[model samples]
Target: MTPKEAIRLAINGRTDIGQVRDENEDHIGWYNHPSLPMGFVVIADGMGGYTGGSKASQIAVKCVTEHLETLPTSTFQACTPDQQLLVIHSKILDALNAANAGILDAKVSAPQLANMGSTIVLALVWQDKVTIAHLGDSRAYLWNKDGLCQLTSDHSLVQEMIDSGSLTVTQARSSRVRNHITRALGVTEFIEPNINTYALIQNSLLMLCSDGLTEYLDHGELEFVLSTHRPALECCYRFISEANEMGGKDNISVGIIEYTLENKVSVSQANISVPAPSSAPVEDVTVRKESRA
Candidate 1:
């Protein structure tokens, strides 16, 4: 079954190799535990060369999503309502660290791939709350009646330039160092992933994606896309298609979680009931599109 049909909370995701890249170095996905109410949405953008970038991105997604999905549901369910959010935060943080370590470990024998690293953004979605942990430049955004609000701060040099008043937002868009991220998975022995938890209002849409989509569509264009009021899957496809239309400068990936009344749980409740799932989780399959040169 497709993610729209099989994934909980109307979650769906898609990724593309883009027009230029020989291999897709981006990964996007969301998967829930076999019996837990929580789900994980991860986006990773890889850098380096010699085919190592793709592997790094794949390792990032695999490490974070697999580790988080298998977390003990009973431990989460057993927590007090107030402690549940904390548990979510810790779980996401721990998983991100693990992903960082996994990427470092993969470089053990391959000397040429030593510089390979990846940007990551992971959202742990539960009832009315999303705890995000990220490193490097992949981002998380929430779109609602209020419009699109960027949920994650980029860990790129351009971002630092913007923060330090050295580069205006417009200038940063075209800055030579825009792609030079300040940090990434496997770059350091210990990683400090940024973490934040947000209250998800009903009808709000949470999007996790790589920089390729953002490089093309600005906030206004994204608003226009959402104004179509399309289903989660359609909106995600629009994101990928539009980015490709804009010259697909890099690999593109998108994962969306639409929070509606149906997915909302009571504030007092620590966990929601999840229907039984099969032995293996269903993955969203993406077709890599080739550009017409």
Candidate 2:
């Protein structure tokens, strides 16, 4: 039997407009196919002014989800598991490209929204593996008994500074330009998303969140929460509440996926190999504490 047929997943998501923001510009969503062993979680953080920010994020989430839903599932299922992963990665990039175009088109129709843009992080899970994709500073993380590992890199000015050895983690956290992102959807004609795949170990958790939660909590704090073994929904609320307690200066969004092997099958020890997308060159930044304005 396929790994997807042998496992179960519990998913939950949450978004909050923190103490300082007058409007919530972050969006989170998840979709699980009824028949196929496939699902996805998406989070977007918008930028620009009040109206533009909200609209841009909403549009990005909607467009990406819609595009992904249209992929040929049966075609993908016919390929080997490794090949299926590549197809999924390609489709995710296609979705992001479509979303970028949709946002750019919205800007043309509404001149005032010219400055609108957004950061997006998405996780597409198929049976025992997951494909994670992202643009800008939003992130994806994996947590298990071993601890928490950040999977996606931040595409931000502060990250660039740290990568160049010009700024230390302590310095970047408080830097005035810490929130300035180097890449975002709709900011340019095209975007190169960082995509990767990983094995979804049984009893492990996958998290996707905007900078809001990361702004307040570090990796140690995140590990503590996941170690509690609470339900995925409870973890989502805890993350949002903790971020708010820590000065909630921006919008917060999170999506959690918990994987479990059912009684029918034993855990597989195979590793899923994911090749980098060939569309554009993407820089891989080391994980760090990131802040948002």
lDDT of each: 0.73, 0.79
Q: In candidate 1, how many Å is residue 28 off? A: 2.0
Superposed on all Cα atoms, the candidates' RMSDs to the truth, in angstroms, are: 10.1, 5.9
lDDT of 1 by residue, 264-288 (tens): 3433223432212222111222212
- Top lDDT: which candidate number? 2
Tell me the deviation in Å of residue 108 in model 1.
1.6
Count steric clashes of candidate 1.
0
Residues 163-282 of candidate 2: C-alpha lDDT, one tens digit per residue:
788997778778999899998888877577777777665567888899999888877788789888476558999999999999999999999987767755565636653323221123
TM per candidate comes to: 0.84, 0.89
Model 2 CA deviation exceeding 4 Å by range: 264-293
Q: In model 1, which range of ten residues has the least summed lDDT? A: 284-293
Of candidate 2, the 10-residue stretch with the lowest lDDT total is: 284-293
